[model samples]
Target: MATTEQGNGLAPRGTKEKLTGDRKRSDPEMNGGVPGEKPVDKYGFTGGAQQHCGESAEEIPIEVLRQREAKWLEMLNSWDKWMAKKHKKMKERCQKGVPPSLRGRAWLYLTGGKVRREQNQGKFQELDNQPGDPKWVDIIERDLHRQFPFHEMFAARGGHGQQDLLRVLKAYTLHRPEEGYCQAQAPIAAVLLMHMPAEDAFWVLVQICEKYLPGYYSAGLEAIQLDGEILYALLRRVSPVAHRHLKKHKLEPILYMTEWFMCAFSRTLPWASVLRVWDMFLCEGVKIIFRVGLVLLKSMLGSQEKLKACQGLYETMELLRAIRPQYMEEAFLVEEIIELMVSEKDIEKEHHAQLRHWKETHGDLHCKSPPRVHGAKAIMAAEPPSRQDLRQRPTFIVESPLAPQTDRVRAEASKENGKSKAEQQKTIKPPQETANPYFPPGDPSPFLNHMTVKASKESLSSAEHDTYL
Candidate 1:
C-alpha cells in the first residue's frame, strides 16, 4: 500500500542517463517497434524493442551484472547443496531478482521443471508430435493469438511464436487429457515461451498446472474458486480496510482475482512488475501470488481518499482494472510484496477451512483429483510416481557432445556395415567425461557431475542424485 517512489534501477525522469555505446538499433522488428525506430533501451526491450510502456530501464553497471550472474551461476551449479544447507541465501538472491538473461534457466531449475523433464524423457516431443484432441486443439488454437498480442513473439498470427505456443498447449492437453485445455493457460504458456524453448515451456507449464497451482485449469475450475474464497478470507486479516470496502459492496474476489491469480498476473501487471513477481513466484511458490494480490488490493483500497472514490462495484472494478501506475511500478510493488507477512502455512490453513465450509454446504467438493502439496519446494521434496515406460529415450541434450546421440547412431551404423566390434570400439575410443554445460563453451570448467544445463540438459552423472542439481 506504500506509494513512496524509489529508483527502480532506472534513473529518475529528466536526469542525465548513463551512456553505454550505441546499443541502439533502427530495425522495426527490434522487439516489434515502429518502422524507422532508431533508439534502444539498455534493458533490450524498450525503444526498438518497445517491449514495455516506453519507459527506459535504469542503467545497471555491467560490472554489477557480471558479479550477480557469477553468484547465481555458482548457486545454480550447486543448487542442491544450497537448497539443503544455504536456502536462506538462495531465497534472498531470488528476491533481488534473477538476471534477465538467466531467467529462463533459473525458472527451469526453481520450478523443478528440468527434473520433471529428465524424469520423463522425450515426453514433450511425444505429446507434441501426436495430433492433439480436437476439442482442446480448437480451443488452444483460438486462444493462442490472444496471449501477448503486443509482444513481438506473438505479434504475428501463426508465426513461430504462436507455433511454439500451440505445440506447448497441445502437448499439455495430450500430456494430461482429463484436465484438457483452459483459456487462461494460453497467457501463462505465452509468458513461459517468452523465456524458454517450446519443450522447456511445456514442462514448466506442467509444473505450474500439476505442481504449483493444482486443479486450477481442470474442467470445473473448482480449485481457483476455492482459492478466490481463500483470498477473500485472508484479505480480512491482510487489510481490513480493503476487506470492509469489499464487504460493503458485496464484491466477490472471483470478479477481480480470476484473471490475476489464474494467469499469475501476466495479463494484469506491467511488464517489469510481472517479471519481478514471476522471479519470486518460481522460487517461493503460489504464496507469492496471494501476497501480490493482497498488496494490490491494500494499495487500491487502503485509504479513505481511495475508498471514497470507489463507492460502488463498478467503480471498484474499474479501479482494479486500471490500477494507478505508481502501485504497479516494479521496485515499489516487489518491495511491498516481500514486506508482507503472508505464509504458505497460513494459506493452507485457510484452504482447509474453506474446504470444510464447501463440504458442509455443497457436499463432496466435486474434486476430480485429491489434495496436493502446493509449492515448488514441496514438489521437489515429494516423490512422483515413476514412469518406467518413458525412460527408453536418452537424456535431454545434456549428453556429452563427444558422444552425442548422433555418435551412438553412427557407431551402430558402422557395425551394420560389416565392421567388427573391436574396430568400432577402437574408432570410438572410450568416451571422456561429460563436457560441462554450465560454463561457457570451451571455458575449461570442472565437471560437476551433479550439475545440469537445461539447454543441453548437460549433466555428468559421476554421482547419482535426485536431479542434475
Candidate 2:
C-alpha cells in the first residue's frame, strides 16, 4: 500500500521520495556491473547490505546476544507473576480496553503459562539435553530448511528468527517424538518467533499442541478434527442458511478455519487482534476459537446469500485476512458474535453431544490418513475419470494392485527386446548392455546428471510435472 522510492533504499518508490529528499547520481555499481566492489552511487551507499556514512565494519558485542537471551529469560520467569495480576485485571479491562503495546506482552505472558514462581533459568538446557531416540531428530533435520521455505518476510531478514525456530522445533521433536514434525507447526513457529523469543515461542507452542489444543499434531489429528466438528455445528446453529448452502456444496468449515484455529488466528488476523483474542484465549481456553469461527460465518451472512454466491472456503479465508474489526464497529460486532455463537452451555460442555453426532455421521471429517509416500501408490488408487473426476486428473505415477504385474510385463518386454538386439548385432560385437531398463535411450549417465543443463534446470512449463514412478 505504501510506495517507497529508490532514494531511501529500504522503502518502495514514491513513499521514499516523499520522506527523503531526492538526490540522483549515475553509478554502474548500483546496476550490478562491478564484481567485488561495494555497490555505490554518488552518495557511496550500497544497494544491498547497508553501511552508515564513513563507518567501518566492526565486531558485534558478545553482551548483545547475552542481553537478548537474558531479556527473554526474565520475561519467561515473570510471566506467571504478570498473569496472576493480569487475570485479576483482564475482565475489567476487556470491559474497558487494553493499551496497544501492553496488549502484545500481556498476551505473550498469559499464553506462555509462566505460572511457577521458581526460575527455569537452567531448565531449558536440561529439557534440551534429555536423551531420546535419534529418529525424530532425523525427521526434524529433513524438514528444517523446508519449514519456512517461502515468505519474503522470513527471507534474508536476519538469521535470528530462523535460528530460533530451528532450535525450538528441534528441541520439541526431541521432547515429543510422537508428534514428530508436522507441516503446519513450522508456519506456526515462524509466526511466534516474529513476536517473541525462540524459547518462549517453543514452550508456548508445546503448551498449545499438548494441553490447550486437542491432539492437533498427533498421529490421529483427533483434536483439530473435533474442533472442526464443533465449528461446523456452531455455524449450523447460528447461521443455518450458510450451513445449508455449504452442505449442498460439500464444503468443510475446516478448510477455512484449520489454519485459523490451529494458529489461534495468528496467521489470519492482524497482530493486534490476534493479541486480543490470545489475551482471552489464555485467560479462558480454546472456546474463543469456536466463538470466533461462529463470528466469521455470521459476518459473512450477507455474502453467503443467493444460491451459495459466497466464494468457496478459500475466498472466505481471504476475506477474513483482508478485513478486521477496526473497519466495523469493533465492540458491537464482537458482542454480536459472542451473543449469537458462544454460550456458557457450549463452552462448559466437556464434549458436546452434537459434536459426537456429527463425528458419527461424518466419519470422513476425522480421517487423517498418512499421506501416500510413493507416487505409484496414488496412481493405483485413482478413481475412474468421470465428469467430476476428469476435472481433477490423476497423478502420473502408476498406482494399482496390478503395479507389480505391470513391472513384470515391462521386465519381460525388456528381456525380449534385449535378446533381439543382441542377436541382430551378433554379426558385429554386441554392445555390452544390461536389461535393467529403468532409463530409456538418450538418458544422461549418472556422472553427467550432476552437470548443469539449462533446459533441465528450468522450471516445468506447465503447472505440474508428470512422475513415472
Candidate 3:
C-alpha cells in the first residue's frame, strides 16, 4: 500500500510536463484531421493507438528525429552483429522506447518478422484469393471495428486500415487452420497492421502465434488456464495482501487476467505503454508480462483507497478495468516494470510447479488434434494418439512419412532417367524421426525429447513462451 509517487526514470519532472503540454497543444486536427472527417474535441476513450491524443503535436527538431531514425536504421542494417555483440545495448534502447517514427521497422526487425515476410512473399495474397472459413470470416468482420475504433486508419468500416486488418486476420486463419480466429487475436493482428504492411503484419502475427505464444489461442485454451495458475502463484509472492484479498473474495485470476494476457495487454494498457511492453517483450520473454501483472495488482489493491473502495470482487474488477490514465503512462509504468527483479528462471520454476499441480488435480489435460493444413498432405506419419495412448506412450515419437515417400519417388525417377538406384540412395537418405507437431521446432526445453506428466513437459519450449498461455 505504498502511495508515494515515483518519477519515471526516463525523464525529469519538467521534461515530462513539457511533453504532456506539447501533446495537448498538438491536437489531432493539427495533424491532417483524421482523413476526410472532422476531428473531435477528444478521441473517445484514452487508450489504443490514440493514447498520445495528439502525437504529431510534439515539435521535436526534424534533425533530432532523423538522428534517432539513423541510429535505428544502422542497428537494423547490421542486426546480426548488433544481436550477437550488443544485445544488452539493444535491450536498453528498447526499454527506453523505440522512436514512434521507426517503431514499425524496429518491431519487424526485433521479431525477425522481416525474414518471415521474405520467405512467404505472395502467400498472403494466395490466402486472400481463397474464400476464408465462413465461421471465422463472420467473427473477424464483426470484431474489426471493435479494435481502435477511433484511430484514423480504421475509423471507416471499409477503409484501407480495416481492409488490411481483415487480410491479416484471414491469412492467419488460413495459415494456422486449427486455431482459427480467436477473438483475442483480432486486436493483436490489428496492432501489428498499424505498424507494418499487411503481409509483414501477417508474418509478425505468425511469429507471435507459432513462436511467441503457441497453444494459447487453441480451442481448449489449456495454456491460458495453466498460466492463470502461474500468475496466482507469482501474486502470492509479490503481493500477498492483494492475493489474500482476492482469495477472500473468491476472485479467480481468469476472471480478470484472461483478456489482459490473451491479448498481450493490447486492451488493458495505454497505447504507449503497450508499445513499450511489446518492445521489451520481443527482446525478453514472458517474464515482462508476469512482472507487469504483479505491478498492476500491487498498484490497484495495495493502498488505503483499496481497503475502502475494492471491498468485493465486483469493485476490485472495476478498479482493474478503469485504472487511472496517469498510472499507465509508459515512462513511469515501464520503468517500474523493468525495475522488478523477476527473471526467466523464476518464471520457469513456477511454470513447472503449476504444471505439476494442474496434473495432480485435473489428471492429463487432453490436447486437441492438430489443425489440418489446406491443400497439403498430413505432415506427420501418424496422428497424435488419444489420451489413453498418451498415458501408455509418453515418448510420443513422430516419424515423417513424406520424407521416405519422396526419397523412393526420387530413386524411381533417377532409375528411369538412367541413373542407378545406388546413386539415388546415396544422394537421398532415409527420413529421420522428428518431434511431435504439438512440439514445434526450436523449442528450448530439456524435457522436449519426452512427453510425460511432468508439468514442464506440457509447456512449449522457452523460445516460444507467451504470457497468454
Best by lDDT: 1
Q: Rate the local accuracy (lDDT) of all candidates.
A: 0.69, 0.45, 0.61
- Model 3 is weakest, by summed lDDT over 10 consecutive residues, at 1-10
Structure candidate 2, residue pairs in collision: 3-13, 3-15, 4-12, 4-13, 5-12, 5-13, 80-114, 379-399, 380-399, 380-400
Candidate 1 backbone collisions, by pair: 10-58, 397-456, 398-456, 398-457, 398-458
TM-scores of all models?
0.74, 0.51, 0.67
For every candidate in turn, the CA RMSD to the true structure comes to: 11.0, 25.6, 17.2
lDDT of 2 by residue, 1-469 (tens): 0122222211221121211113232343222232244544221223322222333122225455344333433333343343345444444443233332233233344443232101244554665666444665554444344322232223332344455666777777766655665545765676555444455567667656655564666654455656676677767777787677566656665455665675566545533345456555654566666777677666665244533544565554445444444332335434653465465467535246644665677654443433211111112123111222112121222223433445555685577676766675664443232221223565422322222222121111111111011
Model 2 earns a TM-score of 0.51
Stretches of candidate 1 off by over 4 Å are 1-50, 53-59, 370-374, 384-469
Model 3 agreement with the true structure over 378-446: per-residue lDDT tens digits: 111122222321121112323344344456556766666786777766776642333422224654223
Q: RMSD in Å for candidate 2, one decimal?
A: 25.6
Residue 437 of model 1, lDDT score? 32
- Ranked by TM-score from best down, the candidates are 1, 3, 2
Which candidate, 2 or 3, has the higher TM-score? Answer: 3
Question: How many Å off is the CA of 129 in candidate 3?
Answer: 2.0
lDDT of 1 by residue, 267-311 (tens): 677777788899899888899999999999999998888898988
Best by TM-score: 1
